[model samples]
Structure formats: structure tokens, C-alpha cells
Target: MNTPNQEAPAQNGKRRTRLIALGVAVLVGVGLYGSYWYLHARHFEETDDAYVASDLVQITSEVAGAVTAVFVDDTQHVERGQLLVQLDDADAQVSTAAAEAELARTVRQVRAVFSQADGLKAQINERQIALRSARADLQRRQKVAADGAVSAEELQHAKDQVAQLEAALNISQESLRTTQAQIADTRIETHPQVLAAAAKVREAGLALRRTRIVAPVSGTVARRGVQIGARIAPGAALMAVVPLDRVWVDANFKEVQLAGIRIGQPVELHSDLYGKDVNYHGKIAGLGAGSGAAFALLPAQNASGNWIKIVQRVPVRIALDPKELSDHPLRVGLSMTATVDLHDGSGPLVATQLRSEPQRVTINEQRDAEVQQQIARIIADNAGHAAL
Candidate 1:
């Protein structure tokens, strides 16, 4: 058996050994964490306060009408130019018909004016020939009367006829001038009256086409508020189209963490919905002009007596690769975690220029082409052929 004093010393030695081992473990842990911060963590900024965002294209009516049909519902995928809704088009159709008839009538009236001018020109030519004939006869009669072979009465009658022909020629020339003035320097298509009528026709056609609401972009429908038989007015919100392919991330970072952030930095993102299995790659597109608090509806009044300092966040826009987005789609307002690489500090903190072109441009395909065809048909039917 060992002595009591020897046992006490042995236990104290064991305690000292344990203390040494714990100290070494702590030192190693700290060193590893420090190395990690220096090599990687320092060159990046991360935030979980990010979300997918896209242009929420609102669908609104350009003309007021009662809803006749709802072609799409919530979450339906629609292509660009596909019809989404239809309004009662009876009034629009009647208006378009009236405009079309007016255009046709105007074309005929312009053609008639051209015809009248040509007729006046013909009358002028005929009057000139008559005057020439009358002058020749008068000269012959005067020559004969001087020789006593022609009677004075016959000679006087010839002179009177020549005078009458000259007066008639002058009247015809004046009439031709008046008619030419009405149709001067313009074709049937370019006439002011015809143009005015054509404008009416275009306006009416646009209204008629507006009755059929089409998708402005290829997107999934959301927030559909219209119903059948609902009377909607111009600018009323019917629904929204969210183009998933055009989505970007809006990451909000604290003010203290924004010093190294810059445009064009590479970003890696993870959506909570997809978890860490799927990673998204993007680049910083821009930085917000101000912090979120500054743009809030009820901004904090820091000047008041009850002021409390709070960390503010600024939004950073990150544009994703279109191909990646196509393969892995994202919806607006989805939560995401973003990590931006700040190794390259050679970019601007804010964009100094605007985009050279618009991101998107939507045109009403049906209204423009259909209206043109209708106008051409009206002109062809009324004026015998379409204007070149």
C-alpha cells in the first residue's frame, strides 16, 4: 500500500497535467480561427438579409370596359403576346367601324377632288382649242370683208364669237386654277383630311385591341384581382407578371460592412428554399443610394430625446447569370444568404452612369399590325387601290 502523503502528491501532479493539456488545446483553436480569418473571411462579406427581386410588371387596362373573360389565373405561366383577359368590345368594335367608314369616305372624297381637278384641266384645254378656232375664223372673215367678198354682218358675228370664246377660255382657266388649289402638292393618302381620318381609325383600333389584354412579357401571373363581369377602368391593376428568368438578388448589409463592398464583385448565394445543395453565382450590379431607414415610411427620428443608435443596412443589387437562372429559377421575395468576394478592390462603390438601353421594351403586337391592315383595306376599297 502507498503512503497518504505520496497519494496526495500524485493527485496534484495529475491535476497539473490536465491543466497543461487544456491550455494547449485553447491555443491551437485560436490559432486555427485566426488563420482562417486572415486567409478567407477577411476578403468577404456575408449576409442572410437578402431576397430575390424582379420587375413586377403590372397589367392594367388602357381603356375602360366590363370584363368579359379572364383567360388566366394565379400562378399560370404565360408567354409574351398571349391573351390574358378580354373586355366587352361591343362599343370598341362600333367605334372602329365608324372610324373605318369615315376613312373610306374621306379617301373617296379626296379621289373625287382629284377627279374634279382633272375634269377642270380637260375643260380648260377644250376652251383653248375653241378660242384658237374662233380667232382663226375671225381673221379669215376680216380679210374677206375688206375684199367685199364677205358681208359686214358675217364679219361682225365672227368677231363677237371670238370675243365670247376668249371670255369662256379665261373662265375655264380660272376654274382650273381654283380646282388645282384644292388638291395642290398632295396625294390622296397625304391629304390633311385623309390623315385626320386615318388617325381616328388608329385610335379606334387601339381601343378595340386594348379590350383584349395580353401579357407584356413571358412570366407567371400573380395577384390576379379581376373577375368576370367586373367593370374595370383605365389604369386599374388587374394582375402582375413576374419574370423568373430576370430575377436578381437584393442583399442588405450593415453600414460597417459596406466599406470594402464595391460594384462588380463576385457573389455566391444560397436560398433557404433550396438549402445549401444549390449555389447561385452572381456579380454586384449596383449599391443603393441610401440606407433602408432613410427610405422607410416612418423613418427614425434620431434627433428626438429618446434616440437609440441602430445599425443601418444598404441594399446591394447582384445580377445572376441568365443561363443559371434559366436552369434554376427563382421567385421574387425569396429569402437568400449572400457572400460577396471583396478580394478585388478595383471597382466603384456606386455606378456613375445610367444604362445605355432599356432592360426591356414591350410593344402591342396586335394593335399596330392589325390597324395598319385595316387602314390599307379601307384605302384600297375606296380609292380603287392602296396608296404606295
Candidate 2:
């Protein structure tokens, strides 16, 4: 009883002192946090609503054929122009051979046309000489007939021979003109018939190359929709190739957050696959023109009775460093956390200028050089001369 009476006041005083100290600590923490927000944290706009994205290049067949072999499967890494599937090349080969043969035959036929022109010129010259001789002979016979030394029948025969020779020469000249019309101002290779046939050959070669479906871009193969012995049609989807190296992050930031964002601003990103320990460096490549709901399949009608204001999100494209991407690969649709630095001076809100240079992807398998070389070989072998 004696201890309780004396210690109660002292215990209350100690508890008050502890409470003061805790209050002071709380005040200092709040001040420090406020200072951080003012000086540092406010400069950055962060969002976890982001994803790794890249172009999903769809690979399709340009020629109809049955699948003979499947070289690549889903999840397999493929290089650009790597053979992914093979069609029943039997049909393609036959078509190619036929086209080549037709090209060769056309070249030969064109060569004959050129030769015929020269032959016609020679024939015209021969006919002209014969006509001149016939006219001279007729003149001599007419002079003899005036002197009564030539018979009337013989003179008439001379006149008829001259007339027939003139008509023959006229026919040969007309034939020469017709022949020249085709070969005029053009070489055998440049002739219309040969050009048309070369086009056919190129078409066939391209189709034959298409039978061996290859990756258009280097990356992992996905959505493999073909199998061995499956007959596929032209323009039908066969597979998809995604270039992981060229991936970028699409950060969906709230509409209010977009005010501070600008293109060309530096960005810091973290992938869910690599965790927060791994960091990625990037730059704000672009901003979305519209919000997610704006481009949605079923956009909300704010004018309706059920209207409720919802914060819309706009996608900001962040282009990452290729080297970092290589070290820590990110696949399409992977989750990411992106933090954009708003410290820099504001530029355009979004990318205003369209891309000056067009993105280009060339097929290594269907090379024009190879096709041209083959066409030249065919033309030379048949035309009896080197292709011009």
C-alpha cells in the first residue's frame, strides 16, 4: 500500500516524458519525409502498371503447299532468315523448273526474232538487186522491140518480169519493217517477251523460296500453327517471331501523371522477371495519343446515367538500352515497373513528328541478287550471248 501511493505520481511523470520524446520523433520524421518529397521524390513519376512489349512479327506463307518438314518449334530461338518450316517443295520445284524452261524458251524465241530481222534485211537487198536487173532487162527489150528485133511476146514477158520483181521487192521491204518493229531500240534481254518471261521466273523463284518458310526477324518462335504434312494456303498464318532484343516498355500512367511526362526524358525500369535488384535504363520514346478506354472494344459512355469519373491511363513508350536488354532479356507482355524522371525541361508532350525513316526488314532468303543471277544465267545460256 505504501509503494503504490508514492510511485503512482512518479510513474505518470515518466510516461509523460516518454510520450513527449515519441511526439518529437514523429514530428522530425514527418518533416524529413516532407523535405524528401519537395527535393527528390516529387521529380519522379512512377508506375507499376507497365509491361514489356515488342513487335509480334507474324510469319505467313506466300505460296500454297503441303508441309514437308518443321524445322523450328514453339519457344525455340531463331535467327533472321532461319528456316522454320518446309512445304512439299515437290510442287514448287516443278513450278520453278517449268518457269525457268519457259524463260529459256522465250529467250531463244527472242533471239530468233533478232536473227529474222537481219535475214529480212538481206532478203530485201537481194530483191532490190533483182528488181533493178529486171527493169534494166525490160528497158533493153523495149529498145529492141522498137527496132523490131525483139518479139512482142518476149517484150511482154520482160515487162511482166519487171512488174513481178517490183512486187516481190515491196513485199520483202514490208516484211523487214514488221520485223524491225519488234527488235527496234531494244536488245534480246530487254525485249518485252524476254522481260515478261524473266518476271515469270522471278515469280516462280520467289514462290519456291517461300515454300521454305523462314523467320523474318530474329527472336523466339511462338504460335506455331503448322505441322508436318499439313497443307497450307497463301497468306495463312504459320507462326510468329518476336524480336526480344528490340523490346520496349509501355508504362500506363494516370491521366494526371501525364502532365509532367515528356518525350526524351530519362526512364528507369525494373522487370518482374529480374526483380528490383536488377535495374534498366531507358528514355521516354513516345506517349499514347488516347487512353486505354478510348481505344477499348467497348468504350464507356460518360453521357449515360451511370456516369462515374474514372482516372484514365495513357501508355508511355520507354525505349531501353540494347545492351541492358541483352543482359536481362524481357519478353513481350512481361510486367515491369517504370519510373520516369521529370527533372529535365519539358519537350513535346508526345512524339509529334512521325518517324522519318521507315522500319525495314529484308528477307535474306529471297535475295534479288540470287534471282537476278539465275535469270541472267538462263538468258545467257539460251540467247547465245551474255545477258545485257
Candidate 3:
């Protein structure tokens, strides 16, 4: 219905309108993506410097012996107090027997001291009677000499008998003193000699217990170096214990990033091993003392270098739920990406105070009864002979 010129101009106008719409749509998309990058991008707290660490426990032998039996091999699972290795206990047995014998002999010696005290009392009584008789005989001899009924030499002999009796009495008193000294020695449980012997017994017992190398903690054994017949000594690193249950995550955040991060703040972590399928929730335990580079073996000599400024990261230890850790075990040194929701600003950014005592590892209540019973038995066995 319209002329060709009008129709051509209208069509051209429509084409121009469509092209403008397309350009606006493209711009809108670019703006949206830019906003997303600003909000959700990985803003790293700069560190080369991550380590896979745990409370590494190095197992060693306290008693010197040839390894008689290696019960658990490398990578074997071990429970707390379970036997891990056994040393040749023949030497320990001999030493322990010797200690027991010495302890028994000490007990008998102590008993003998009491017996000696009884003997001294009896000897003192007998000497008192003999001294009385000797005095009476001397008085009779002096009267006879005065009357000239007995010779002077005979009187002198009687006087000498009295003097000899007195000397014997003094010797008996000295004997009583020596016995009393022996009793005093027996009463001292903490005497140097007794203590030395008791210490040997304790040492021998400890050595005997150590022959059966029980696991100190429940964990998986790794890097075991000892085998049957290997002679081991004190402090020789034989293996390591890997505790998957007590694993904790260390999040390194930048100084600027620390503004929102605080103790007790809620956090969400995702590990590369488990991915986003399992989300680990945690709370900020505390921030590290210094930056990672500060603790380096050879710290940067920033004084003389070409001054290039770099941001530093400090490690923030995050504590995870034990239930979650138990459900899914995480190995030490696994890579993880963490995010802290800084919504709650209730706690301090840096802890101003510290605890006076160490936080106790929860006591194992299951073994309480058994331990009490064992202690009672030991007290009963050592009661009559030794007090403790």
C-alpha cells in the first residue's frame, strides 16, 4: 500500500533498531559477568607456603634390644595400647628377677633389724643381773680382806672380776646402740641405698613393659624402619602415626582479608579430594602468630633487595566437627578451598588473652574401672613389705 521509497526507508529503520537492541543485550551480559567476577572470584591470600601437617608423633624405643617381633607392618591400622612391636625381653626378664630378689632381701633385712632389737633387750637384762652379782661378790671379798679371812691377792682377783664385768656391761650397751642404728637404717624407706635399689626395680619394670611396644595413639602406621632382629635404641625414629580423625584445616588469609575473619566465626570448606559434595563446617579457632615467610628457614633479607612489595598470608587454624571427621577421614596435607562467612562480628579479631593451662585431651572413661582395679592390686601386693 505504501510507495517504494517509504517502504525502503521503514525497512532500513527497523534494521537499525534491531542492531541497537542486540548491542544493548551484549553490553548487559558483559556487565553482569564483570559484577560476578568482582563478587565471587578466588582472592588468594598469597602463599607458596602451604604444608600438610598434623600432630606428628614419632615412635621410638626406650629400651635397648633386638627387635624380636614386629607385629604391625607399615601402613597397618593400630588402636591405642595395641601392641606394635616386641623386643627381646630375655635381658629385661633377668634384670627384673634380680630386682625382685633384691627387694625381697631388703624386706628380710628390715625384719632382721626388729629381731636384733629384741636380742639387745635380752642381752641388756642379762648384763644387769651379772653386774649385780659381780658387785655383791666384790663387797663380800672386801669384807673378807678387812677381816684378813681371805688373802689380799684373792681380794684383788675378786675386784678385777667386778671391773671386768663393768667393762663387759659397757660392751653390751655399745652392742645395743649398734642394733638401734641398724633399726634406724631399716625405718628409712627413702634411704639412698633402698631408693637406688627401688629405682632399679622401676627401671627394670619399665623396660619390660617397653619390650612390648604398644601404640601410644590410635592411628595408621607409616614409615616403619624396624624389623625382626633389628637392634634399636632410645629415641631412634622407627615410624610415624597418621591420625585421620584428629585432622584440622589451616586456612591462610591475607592481612586485608583478616578484617572480616575473627575467632569463632563460622566457615565453610571444600576439599579437592572430596569436592563440593561434602561441605565441612568449622569455626575459627585462632590466627597464627606471624606471617608464613617470617618462619622460613632462610627468611627474605628485605633490607637489601630491589624493593618489590608483596602481600603476606598468615595461617588461621580452623577446628572442624569430630563427627564429620569421623564420617569422612581426611589425610594430612590435602588441598582445600575455604570461605568464612563474616556475618557475625561478635568475637575479637585477634585474641588479647591466652589460656593458663593446656586444653585437656578428653579422658578415656572406659578404662577407668580397669585402671582402678590394677592400682588396688599393686597396693595390696606391696603393702606388707613396702608402703608404696
Candidate 4:
């Protein structure tokens, strides 16, 4: 109904609207992708290859023996100092009895040595008196011979008696010196021989105690390799104690992802086992010194004729809450996904940069008083019986 030029204006107006819509769509698309890139810049920090790990102490026999009893089976929960196994203790008992007998013999020998000192003193006094009597007799015989009452032979015999007495006195004096020297040389308190023998007794006692294998840590046992009548030796792997409370996650992060990573930063994790139903709370405890492959048995030989560049990942240790770990027990090597918010980059990249060594194990301050009391009771019991 309108002219051609008027219709052209209408078409131009419609074209402008379409171009505006297209421009708006392009801007929104660009903005969305940019936001995505910014949010996931540290995606490498959240690794799917991360795993839960903890210190696994392998229990082994310190003494060689045939296992007589296995108190714990695989997956058994044990407390520290709880007996785990018992070896054939007949041999250990025999050794302990022999050591006790040897200790008693040593005590008797020391007492005898002390008594011999007194006996030697008495013998020395007797010899001194006998020598004086012999000298007096010789003088009397000489005077009597001059007066012609005694024969010259009798005087000579008296002189000979005095000479023999002198020899006997010298021998007695030498024996006294030797006995006194021995008394001075022998020490009742920790003499070398006594120490050597005491060490043997201690060794025997330790061996006897080892016959009853005890758990070194409080945890659940796994991978048990012991059975009744099984012979074991030192350093042999018997069982493993997995302390769930001490479990931590080791996340390998790319080098680029660590630019904003800081110690004490909070972490949120979800394990595959839990399927996002459970959330774990943790903090960045530390960073590994080097890549994992660097610690492998057969490391890559980069110095060879052929070499290729590979992206290495560094391990970051994250300490989880004990409550969380206990609530949801995680086995070693369980896969997990972790996210660390790096919004606060003011914190130190390290934990205190401390030169001081961290204590691997610590005594609970709350239980110190109780532990001391128990230790005191043990000492009193031992000292009260045979303090001497």
C-alpha cells in the first residue's frame, strides 16, 4: 500500500533490529566463555589422580621364633601395646633362666671377693706375729751360746728359723697387696664384666618379651602374613596398621596451578566412593619438594641420546579433619577431587618457612600426668622387689 522508498525505510528498520539481536548474542557468548576460563584457571590444582594416604607401619618380629599363637587376624582393630602374637617361648624362657642364674652367680662371686679382703688382712697379722717371735728366739739363742749354755748349732738353727720366717712374711705381705689391689679393682656398681653380663640379661629379657608380639600402634590391622607355627625373623613384614585418623590426601598439581596456592588455604574435597554425598574439609599442609617420578626406583634418564619434554606434577599434602575422616573412612589410594579457593593469596606459600624439624609423634599433654603415674608405679614395683 506504500511507495517503494517508504517500504525501503521499513526494511532497513527490520534489518537494524536483526543486527542488534545478533550483536547481543555474540557479546553474551564471548562473556560466558571468558568467565569460564577465569573460574577454572586453577583446574589443574584439582586433580582426579589424587589419592588418600597415611603412614602404614609394617609390624615385624624382632626375634626369630616359631609362632605359637596368632591373637589378631586380618582387619582386626588393636590398641597400642596389645599382644598380637605369641611365639614358642620355651627357648626364650630357658635363655632368661640362664641369665638369672648367671646374675646370681656374679653376685656371689662379688661377695666372695669382698670377704677375701678380710681373710687376707687376718693372715697378714698372724704372719707378722710369727716373724717377731722368730726374731726374739734368734736373739735369745745367740746370747745363750755366748754364755756357753746353748750349742752353736742351736744358734745357727734359730738364725735359720728367723730367715725362713722373714721369707714367709715377705710372701704374706705380697699376697695381702695382691688381695687389696683386687678389692680396689673390683667395682660392685656397674663393673665392665657386670655390665656385659647385665646386657646379656637385658637382651635375654627383650628376646623373651618379643616372643609375645605387641602392636606398636593403635589401628586396624590388614595384610597380615602370620599363622600358627610360622617362623619369622627381624624386618619381616607381618602386618600393617592403618591409622584412619592420620590419613591425608596427596594431590598432584601442575606447576601453573600453584601460582596462587598458599599454605593454610581451605580445601573442599569429594571422594568417588561418596559420590558427592559427603564433603571433606581440609587445609593445605605442605607441598612436595620434587615430582613423584624423581623418587622412583628407575628414574627417567634425561641425559640419554633421546629426550622429550613431559609435564611434571608436584604433590601437595592436604590435612583433613579427624572428625570427617572418622565419619567416612577412606582407604589408601582412594581417588578424590579437590578444590582450593585461591582468592586469598596473602598467606605464605610455605607453612611458616620453619627451620625447626616437625615432630613425627607427640605425647598428649592431657595424658602426661596419667602416663607419669603409670611409669612411677612400674619403677616402684621393680625397685621395691630387688632394689639392691
The estimated TM-scores of all candidates read: 0.93, 0.85, 0.72, 0.71
Candidates 2 and 4: which is better by TM-score? Answer: 2
lDDT of 3: 0.73
Cα lDDT tens digits, model 3, 1-388, are: 7999879999999999999999999999998988875665433222223333467767888778898788888778888788788889998899878876675566556555656677778988898898899889889888778788999898888889888888888888898898777656445354444456566666676667777777778888988888788988888888877876777888787877777677988877777778889988888888899988999999978886597878988898888888988887788888877777766778886877876665332223323444344334433344354333
In terms of lDDT, the best-performing candidate is 1
Worst 10 residues of 4 by lDDT: 359-368
Tell me the spans in candidate 4 whose CA falls farther than 4 Å from its real position.
Answer: 1-19, 25-45, 121-173, 183-186, 275-277, 296-310, 343-388
Among these predictions, the greatest TM-score belongs to 1
> Model 1 compared with the native: what TM-score?
0.93
Q: Which lDDT value does model 4 have at 306? A: 80
Candidate 3, residue 100: Cα displacement in angstroms equals 2.9
What is the C-alpha lDDT profile of model 4 across 232-306, one tens digit per residue? Answer: 887778888887777999999887677778888888999999989999999998888888889889998899778
Q: Score candidate 4 by lDDT.
A: 0.76
Q: Clashing pairs in model 3?
A: 52-333
Q: Point out where model 2 deviates above 4 Å.
A: 1-23, 129-164, 364-369, 385-388
Rank all candidate structures by their lDDT, best first, as comma-separated numbers: 1, 2, 4, 3
lDDT of 2 by residue, 1-388 (tens): 5698899999999999999999999999999999999999999999999999899999988888888899988899999878888887777788889999999999988898888888888988998898899989988988879889999999999989989988988888898889889988999889999999999898888777777778888899889988888988889898898889899999999998988888999999998898999999999999998999999999888998888899999999999999998898888999999998999956788577888887676884346668889998998889885234
- lDDT of every model, 2 decimals: 0.90, 0.88, 0.73, 0.76
